[model samples]
Target: MPNRRIFNSFFLGGFECSSHRRPDGRRLDLLSATGHDRMTDADYRQLSAHGMAAVRDGLRWHLIESAPGHYDWSSFLPMLRSAEALGTQVVWDLCHYGWPDHLDIWSKDFPDHFGRFAAAVARLVRDETGPQAFYCPVNEISYWAWAGAEVGRINPCAVGRAGELKRQLVRSAIAAIEAIRAEDPTARFITAEPLINVVSGSPEPQHIFDAEQYRLSQFEAVDLLTGRIEPGLGGRSDYLDVVGINFYPDNQWYLGGSTIPLGHHAYRPLSEMLEEVQARYGRPILIAETGAEGSARPAWLHYIGAEVRDARARGISVEGICLYPVLDYPGWENERLCQVGLLGEAEGWEKRSVCVRTASELRRQQALFEDVAAPEPATAAE
Candidate 1:
């Protein structure tokens, strides 16, 4: 059997560390709101106890680089140290939907400043931790483009300029990847984006084309990063590394109507989606983020897990799955308890309680996969 690379664990805990500007121009820091920022030690302990050996987390760009070219590692150092002590591997998000206020995202300087900051981060992490690192350069280029540029729902607040913003983000991400690689030769990158299916509401050719185009648009960011499309943004084939697919219950929907009922005639099986991604890029893939709120969380994981197993059975290098927002946090638009995490917040900032139902299901699913050993790759097609 060929040597296979896997993350430290098949299960990962993803902190909801979104630091983004809301529609009202207010900067929201979810790490602070959930108290995870101040409770790194306790959080790491809980993660290890729950058999989560890897995590997806992020740095608050605005806080660290309060001024141009200045980064305050004081805020992030503790978390890094804690994760290292706990033997947890981390995939950090360099730009989690927010950046320094002094920088103009539209200006050419955005990528320049971001690249410099990324290089500096790589150096500090390499020196302090002395291990290979993984990074998602920008959290979700696709969703950010639509929400921030097209709808005027977030920062940069540009209406009808999503394509332009996406190019800018791709430029920044490419620059960051190059800078980080220059600092640490072995750095790996994961591009996190929503994977979806779109269907036309009618049988008209135009409607069909619209849906097909909408579906294709989801891959634009990754395509740009890979030089498969939009090579002008300094994208190249080397820049595209691992791919992280973020899926939710509502991801599959009619182009102009309600959510597509799963298992319906039009609903695409996630196995097919994973296959399309593999056939397109042939890179390692991870279900970077998947979760649900309330009682549906465990069932959602079970369903996705089974699909992932099926994908792997087809010889896809589908990697481990991640439960994003492993700890419940407030909703972005409202302070309402999202209840989407495997763990629930406790009264004390440093403590959390596992959602018993989700935890049980996770163990059951883990056992289910373990029972079926991974089949050896076929050396010759029969």
Candidate 2:
């Protein structure tokens, strides 16, 4: 077995459990849609077979809290129990771009109320599964802001209010952290944000500055959490625990232009990006979400694993890399089958089906990791 720190395994599987509504106002339950919710035990067992001892999943806020001050754990408890039974450590995501229908996001007490709910969740988990649980409150604040506020892509479907949405998400997350600590002090939090690089396409100096600034905007969420940039949101150093970053092939681009894929001339190396993140926050990092769709899976994984290996060689404390949405599911926009996950949809609730090539590649990487992670032999005795 590999000797691993921070998590039981160096690799983690993430499920796409987005409960957000589309711009057309139709609610999406990706977990249920993919049958993971109904097949928790099998899902976890399948992940464990792939050597993923840790997983990143979500608890649908809207489904959990149907009414104010009340919670229905019908959809969550079973999944938690399944993970425990399968010996899979989980980093739970609370509020993944969706919330209770009765509550207004812009309301004055949103943060406080969210904090209270988060506290209750912490207590529930502690009472059920014991301590040292991981949580990501209000997942991807910066991305959510851009999606929901800037482009009206998702719920709360507002436009021209990116700053406002960001501030609110940070406030809610901060408040939730405090509330959760009140319930369980040993609980760890993950501030998951995108790590991207942008370059200027224009020769104008102002354009260059704008592009760079936009790149820096990716750190605003963690900056607020650590009180580095936006202290007004009540962020403190302690609030920034394990820094989680999401990266994909399309992460880099030229400002006002096309995406610069990995290995392109203008594309930035992921190792350099990881180094910058370490320099900025001075905390351990987890590649919370990363994967490519269809035939790009194997190559993307190889690239990411190499980058992470290089990052660690440079003494960066990169804890793990997660194959996000490790199970193939319907797309949020058009419900198309995204063949990204290592596992495909199962025919039944107890048996799990997998993508063969994906599974092979995953195991190949696992064996390689084990070789590196194994301890050295004993020295010659006198």
Candidate 3:
């Protein structure tokens, strides 16, 4: 088994830091909505108690770069400091489906401005926190492409432009990687994208072919980044670093049909999926996002934990599993409370309630993976 000391812990917490504009033009700031922005210190402290010393968080690009060529780290500095103080390792997402309104996504200026912004962020983070850092330059490129261009549900709402938007995002990510490397060559990256399985609802040959094609589309962004396709975008094998897969219960579905229920004949085991990804990329894999709402939370985590163990036993370098949206927040489309986090919604940190069931499950998982995580090397500071 590959017992690499990648993350600080085998499990990770993830704050919902989505900063995207709705199709109707209303901007959503999940960090603020969940009170994480105000309770950064408290949030990190709580995660530490839950054994999540590492976390996935975001930098609100729209807030930081409200104007072109200008960055106001005022929106992000506190969060960075809080993590440093708490000794929390963060995979900072530079762009989580949001960008400055002054820039056009389709224009060449988008990547140009993003590269500069990423370089600036790298310098600041290195100055404050030290040499080692992790970044997800452009989060969920595949999903963002579909949401923004194919479905017209988010920014740059353009129908049938997913291909164009996807390429643009790839270019932007490559540029950001290049610029950040110039600042801190030791920086790591997480290319997070949704992992899905699509099965044909019909036995017809054409239907099966279409379903398979749609399912394979999930790899488009990673392939572009690896220079497997579209080499003109300046992607190289090294550009694709850690493979971050965001899996949800609803990820697998039948083409043109409803979500495929678990245990159904066509339902694929996550371990097998992990194996396929390992075979393809041959890089470290992180379950960068996975969780369920309310009553389903414990069982969902248990399922993923078991699958990850299975993958690891098979020699797949499964690095860690992140419980995304570690705190509950309001829904995107509607403001309904989504009970998907281990920590429940609260007006203040004192009022927050930890989901006992989920927390217990997490502890149980930690115990299971404790032997899998290698001991950390002692730091001079320690």
Candidate 4:
């Protein structure tokens, strides 16, 4: 069992800070679109009002690095100051599927430039916060590779290049970790990847094999980072530090079929999945992202919270559950309102309406988990 606590709160609010460009060539700045950039102080205060003291946020690399080797912290400083002032611990995402337009994703310079940018950001964070910092170096490398390189749905929209893109992302993540550690040796890292299950309804052997292979592919990026398969990428066991799994309702489906409904026999319990992750990595785990839309929010939280308790009771070192996009945001492709947050969309400093049901459930879970002893603070130096 792990003896150290990884976050200030077991329940965390995650800001959707994706800045990826759409396939139509329009860049999406979710922070501004959802008014989070203008309401950082209110956001932190709101999280505190709901019994949360930790958050998962991102640094917009595209906004920060306007020119090669140059950075402007104008866009990120205010949020950092707000979190620090309000005593909210934050896990920062250095690259969240967006980068400066000048850089080519396939170029050898990509990782090197990313390393430099990460080091600069680390230095800023170390100076603003302290020795202890948590960072998800690159968000969802597998998903990014698939969406951007494989399916041509987003920027760097190249078909049939996901393998190349995945390797590049792994390299970039290793570089970021190395650079950040150089700036702040005590900084802890989290690798957030989608937790998925692919089942095959067909009796054909090839179909079954394909489904299993697809399911296992979810671990590719983490494996590459841990040097489990690609030692030449400068990966090491420590680079895989804290395992962050992002789960959602649509995460599981049959090979050529629809989603496996929550209670179906084919639906795997989240506790079972967490056990697999912990057993494989022998490291702390975090539900780095999890949430549902509309009326599903409260029940989803209840279900996830319960499973987390089950995992903990079995001695799995599950650290925390983050309500990703804790505030609703505009959809990535359609620009439709995604009502998936505990708080709804708002303008400027206007107070956002709360999802009363989800907030109440969150409070209830907080009380239930209260009996569990809080562990000592965790650090990379541990």
Off by over 4 Å in 3: 374-382
TM-score for every candidate vs. truth? Answer: 0.95, 0.95, 0.97, 0.97
Worst 10 residues of 3 by lDDT: 373-382
lDDT of 1 by residue, 1-382 (tens): 1224456767788998888898788898998888888988888788777777778988998999998888898878998889888878899988989998898999988888899999989998899887468889999999999999999888988899999999999999988998998998788788999999999989899999999999999999999988887677788888877889999999998888999977799989999999999999988788899998899999999999899888888888876789988989988888899999988876576668889999998888767655332322212101
User: Candidate 4: where is the Cα deviation over 4 Å?
Assistant: 1-3, 347-350, 372-375
Given candidate 2, what's the lDDT at residue 103?
Answer: 93
Candidate 4, pairs of clashing residues: none
The alpha-carbon RMSD values of the candidates against the true structure, listed in the order shown, are 3.6, 4.6, 2.6, 1.4
Q: Native-vs-model 1 lDDT? A: 0.86
Deviation (Å) of 28 in candidate 3: 0.6
Worst 10 residues of 2 by lDDT: 373-382
TM-score, cand. 4 vs. native: 0.97
Which is superior by lDDT, 1 or 3? 3
lDDT by residue (tens digit), candidate 2, 215-330: 99998877877788767679888888888999998899999899997778889999899999899888778899999999899888988888888888888878788999898889
Model 4 local distance difference test score = 0.90
Order the numbered candidates by lDDT, best leading: 4, 3, 2, 1
Superior candidate under TM-score, 1 versus 3: 3
Off by over 4 Å in 2: 1-4, 371-382
| Candidate 3 per-residue C-alpha lDDT over 1-382 given as tens digits, one digit per residue, 9 for 90 to 100 | 9467678887889999888889899999999999888888888888888888899999999889887788899989999999999899999999999888888889988898899999999999999998768999999999999999999998878899999999999999999999998998888898899999999989899999999999999999999999998888888999877899999999999999999988889899999999999999998899999999889999999999999999999999998999998998999999899999988766466446799999999999999999855446412110
| Model 4 residue 140 distance off true place after TM-score fit, in angstroms | 0.3
